[model samples]
Target chain A: AQRVTQPEKLLSVFKGAPVELKCNYSYSGSPELFWYVQYSRQRLQLLLRHISRESIKGFTADLNKGETSFHLKKPFAQEEDSAMYYCALRFMEYGNKLVFGAGTILRVKS
Target chain B: DAMVIQNPRYQVTQFGKPVTLSCSQTLNHNVMYWYQQKSSQAPKLLFHYYDKDFNNEADTPDNFQSRRPNTSFCFLDIRSPGLGDAAMYLCATSRAGKTYEQYFGPGTRLTVT
Candidate 1:
């Protein structure tokens, strides 16, 4: 079975500080990973994907197969960056059903 | 601009009553999905339609049904909603195949009284 795990329920950081949200996955076959964000009063949107290898809103995530992890990171956190973050995985063989993590609520304090 | 739209940002229904949530998209994406999200929990996939091919998750309850008449519209119908069924129903769409990113709507929050 494919599963994504995000152990942190709430993460607090001061503005301008670096931030990291951890995510891990378990799947036998090759998988595609993604990070999604939901800002206040906004719909959940894709923040970045491992396959894209690009940063969005200064957030970057590196997929590590060996560790079975795809943790989201940002060099400096901002007040506007606070939101709910979810990590997801898509099985290569499955019909593209996305398995999501429990999600972490990031609160950047000014 | 292309986007996914879900009607009734908030919905209140009596227990054991039937409720229908609607979703529409202008992106013309070939794939559409419905997910149920509870407080502090991950969004669980209920069902999805890929060009009218309906697929239901194994763990999804029978009371939860979905219909997709075309590429742009999809509807989720709960035959008899229980208190446990109250959650935020999210609608998302992705382009043909698996290369494109999924776009999500603002979601419909269901409150069962």
Candidate 2:
């Protein structure tokens, strides 16, 4: 079974602080991992993908196959960065279906 | 700009009544998907259309049906919505490939009364 787990329901941080949202997956096959963010009154959009190996809005995530984890990290948090973040995974052999984590709400306070 | 569009940002329907949610895309992507997201829960895939090929999830209920009339338009029909069916239905589109990313719409918040 393909599953994603985001244990924290909320992660509050002060502006300029480093932030990290944890994500773990249960899959034996090669998987494509993604991080999606939804801002207030905005649509859900892609923030980052493991395949691209690039940072977006100063956030980056690295896939660790040994741990089966793809954790999202940022050097410094901003007020505009406060949003709901979801970690998703796609099974390579499963017709390209996406499986999402429960999500983590990042509240960046000044 | 080319993007995915979902009509009726908010909807209110009586229990056991039928409701339909519409999605259209200007990106001309080859794949369209329908997802149901409950409050505080991750979005769950219900069904998707790869061009004209319809694919349904194994756990999807028979009451939930989808139709793709053309390349740009797709519809999700709930034959008899229940109270538990109230959720935000998300529409997304992607090109047929392993790397192409999916673009999501603003989503429709369905309220079952």
Which pairs of residues collide in candidate 2?
Answer: none
Global lDDT scores for all candidate models: 0.92, 0.93
Error of 2 at B60 (Å): 0.4
TM-score of each: 0.96, 0.97
lDDT of 1 by residue, A5-108 (tens): 99999999999999999999998668899999999998888888899899899999999999999999999999999999999998866667788898999999
lDDT of 1 by residue, B13-95 (tens): 99999999999999999999999999889999999888988999999999999999888999999999999999999999998
**Largest DockQ belongs to which candidate?**
1
**lDDT value, residue B27 of candidate 2:** 89
DockQ of 2: 0.68
Candidate that would win on TM-score: 2
Model 1 regions lying over 4 Å from their true place:
none
Instruction: List the TM values for chain B, per candidate.
Output: 0.97, 0.97
- Relative to the true structure, candidate 1 reaches a TM of 0.96
